[model samples]
Target: MPDSKYAAYQPAAPYFDLVRRALGDRVDGAHFFDLVTDETVYEVLYDVPGWPRVITGRDALMAAFRGYVGAIALESADRLVVHVADGGAVIVIEYEVRGTILASGVRYANRFCSIITIGNRKIVHWRDYMDSLAAWAALTAPRGV
Candidate 1:
C-alpha cells in the first residue's frame, strides 16, 4: 500500500514518482533541468569540513551537479525511502559513485536525506543533507592500484 500520510496531498505522490523515474540510469544532468520548473528554486544547505553554509540558486546548482558528474564515471542511487508530511515530503536515499579521478579508479558511497517542499505540483524548495567528511574523502582519497 502507498503511504497513508500522502493521501491528503493530491499532487505529492505523482510528483515524487515523477522525480524518482526521471533520476534513473538513462537520464543525465539535462533531465533534471527539464523536470524542474523554469522558476523553480533549489536551496542546498550543507556544512562540510572546510566549507561554510552554502546557498545556491538554480544555475549554480546545475553547475555544481555537472561538476560532480564530470568527476565520476558512473553514479546511481538506491534505497530510496519517501516520507510524506501533510504539507511536505522527505526522501532518504543512498548513492554509489564510481569512476576514475585523473585515470585512477575510485568509488565513493554516500547517504542523503533530502527534504522537498511542493507548491502547485512543482518542487518549490529542496534542501539536501549529507556527510561531508565522507564526500571529501571519496573525492580526494587515493584509488586502488
Candidate 2:
C-alpha cells in the first residue's frame, strides 16, 4: 500500500503500474515528469532496434518510453518474483506485462527481468532485459492472422 502523502501518484491501471512496484519508496517525490535526477542511468541490455542502450535523466527516459507507450496499451503487469539484495539497495525483479498493440490490435505479452538500484530512496540505476524476439513477433504478425 502506498503512503497517504504519495497516494495520488499511485500506479493506476493502463499506465505505469509496473514502474510503481519498481519504484517502491522512491515514488514519494517521483512522477513520470520528474522521474530521474542528474545521476540517474537507465539501461536496456538487449539490442532493441530503435532504442538506445543507455538513457540518462527524466527527459531522456521519457523520450525512450514515448514510442513504447504510444504503441501498446498495457492491460496488466504482474511481478513473478523479486529478490532484494545489498541490504535492500539492489532489487532484481522478474515480471510479465500483457498488452495490446494500438495499431494492430494484436495481443502482446512479454516477460522481463529488471535490476534496480535505489539510493536515498530514489532510483539511481535501472537495467532491464526482455524477450526481444517475442516483442518482434507480436509487432510483426499480421493483424487478425
Candidate 3:
C-alpha cells in the first residue's frame, strides 16, 4: 500500500520504485515509462559556455535514455534524498554508472545528481547535473581496475 496522501496520484510506488530498479539494475523498458506523465519534461543544465542546455518532453527524454541504455550500467544510488511539500515532491539522487563505451569499448565511471519533481504522483519535471569533464575523462582514461 502506498501513502494515503498519494492515493489520488495514479501509479504511485511502482513508478518511483521502477526507476530505482531500472537504473540500479536492468529492467524492462515499459516499466520505466509507466511513471512518466505524458507531458513530463526533463532538463540537463551545463555551465560551460556554448553548451546548450537540454530540454525535452517525455518522448525525447525516453529517446535520449534509450541511446545510453547499454552504453552505461547504472550501479547504485549513493545519496538519495526526498522532500515532499504542498502537493509536490522533489527527489535528489546521486548515483554512479560504469560500463564500456559502445563505440570505443573504453571503461567509464561517472557520477550523477538528478533532481526530480513529482505531481499527482506522476513525474512532471526532472533536472540532472554531472561533472562533464569527469565523465569525459573517465570514458577516455585507462581503467582503474
Candidate 4:
C-alpha cells in the first residue's frame, strides 16, 4: 500500500500527496493505499457510471478507480485544501481533477470535497462529493468537439 500500484491510474496522487505533506506526522502512510485500512469504506454522495454510492474495502475502491480511468483519463489533480480536526481523526479535503473523456474526447474538470475519518492511524471511512453536472457535460459532449 506504499503507492498507487492498485489503481490503473494515479490521477488523485497529487491531491493525496498534498494531504500527506499537510498532515505530516499526524497521518500514517506514504501514499493513498498505505493510509487506508483494508476494510475502508468509501462513499460517494452522487451517482456516477463507474463509481458507486458505497464501496467497502481498499481493493474495491481501487477497482472503482480503474473503472473511472476507463471513462476519464485524468491529466492533473490539484488545488487541494485540507483541514484536520478531532485530534487528527477527521480530515476534510477540497480538490479538483482535470482530464479528458475517453469516449467523447471532451475536456473534463470537476471539483470535489471529501471527508475522511481515521482510526488506528488508518483511514477507515471516506465521504465524497463532486460536481456531477460538470462530469455529465464532459461525458456527454460530442467527440473532439
Candidate 5:
C-alpha cells in the first residue's frame, strides 16, 4: 500500500466528476461527488475493531479509502437514489459499489447510504452506512479459483 497521503492536486474518480457536473449546475450550498481532503470532516456510522468511526481531515480519510481501493478494483460506482434535503445542507445518497478483490479474486459488491454536507464546493461532513457483514464475507473468503 502507498504510504503517501492525499494531495489536493490529485485527481478524483470519474464517478465523482460525473456527479459534480450533473449537480453543480443545480445546487448552491451542496458539493456533490467531491474528494474529502485534509480540510474535510467525515464520520462513518459503522464501527469495526480497527477501522475509524470518526474521520477528521482529508489525509486520514483518504488513507482509509486508499487502503480499500487498493484492495478492491472498482468496476462501477452507482448512486441509485439521491435526496437533497434540509435546504441543501444535508444530502442523502444511496449507492452501490461493485468490484473485485485483487488478492482474493473474489467479487465484491456493497450497498451504501451516505448523508453528506457540502459547503463552498467542498465536502465538510459525511456519514456512511453499509453492509459490513457482507463486506467481511467477501474479504475473508478463500483466495483461489
Candidate 6:
C-alpha cells in the first residue's frame, strides 16, 4: 500500500519499481510521485480511452492515476531498458506491464517507451509512447472471466 500522502499514486507502484531500479541512486524519491516536480508535464503520444493525452502537474497526474487503478489492476511491470543521455539530464526507458481489467477478468498487456527529462533531480517532463492497440483490445474484451 502507498502512504496516505501518495494514496492517489497507488497505481504507479509496478511501474515505479522498474524506474527505481533503472535510476538507482540517480534520483531521490521513496515513491514514484515524489520523483516528479510539482509542475511536471506528462504527455502520452498514443490515444487510450479513459486516459488523457496530455497531463500537467503532479496533482493532475495523481488524479489520472487514481482513475487508472480503478480500471486495471497491474500484476507486474518489467522488461526495463534504460538509456541515459546528456549527462543524466535525459533518460529513455522502455518497459512492459501486465494487468487485469477490473470490470472484467481479461488480462491486459502493453509495452511503453518513455522519454524523461530531469531537472534538479526530479522529473520535469515526460513523453510516453505505448501499445495502444493492445490496450484497446483489453479494454474491449468480453466481460466476465
Best-matching candidate per TM-score: 6
Q: Tens digits of per-residue lDDT for model 3 on 1-145?
A: 2345333322223334435453432222334455565687777775433233674565665555554543444432344444444444676666555555555656665567777776665667778788888667655655442
Q: Using TM-score, rank the candidates from best to worst.
A: 6, 4, 2, 5, 3, 1
Evaluate model 3: give its TM-score.
Answer: 0.62
Q: Which clashing pairs does model 1 show?
A: none
1 or 6: which has the higher TM-score?
6
Question: What is the alpha-carbon lDDT of model 6 when measured against the actual structure?
Answer: 0.85
Better of 2 and 5 by TM-score: 2
lDDT of 2 by residue, 33-141 (tens): 4445677899999886678999888667766667666677778888668788998888888888888877898988889898988887667898999999988988888
Clashes of 1: 0
Q: Is candidate 3 or candidate 6 better by TM-score?
A: 6
- Which parts of model 1 have CA positions greater than 4 angstroms off? 1-19, 22-30, 47-57, 87-103
Give the local distance difference test score of model 1.
0.49
TM-score of 1: 0.60
Answer with 3 or 4, whichever has the higher TM-score: 4
Residue 5, model 4: lDDT of 62
Runs of candidate 3 exceeding 4 Å displacement: 1-18, 21-30, 47-52, 73-88, 139-145
For each candidate in the order shown, give its overall lDDT on alpha carbons: 0.49, 0.72, 0.54, 0.77, 0.65, 0.85
Ranking of models by lDDT: 6, 4, 2, 5, 3, 1
The lDDT, on a scale of 0 to 1, for candidate 5 is: 0.65
lDDT of 1 by residue, 22-85 (tens): 3443223323444455565665566553333443455655555554444544433455666666
Highest lDDT among the candidates is held by which one? 6
Query: Which portions of model 2 show Cα errors greater than 4 Å?
Result: 1-15, 30-35
Q: Write the residue-wise lDDT of candidate 6 on 32-143 in tens digits.
A: 7788877899999998878899899988988888998888888889989999999999999999999889899899999999999888888889999988899999999898
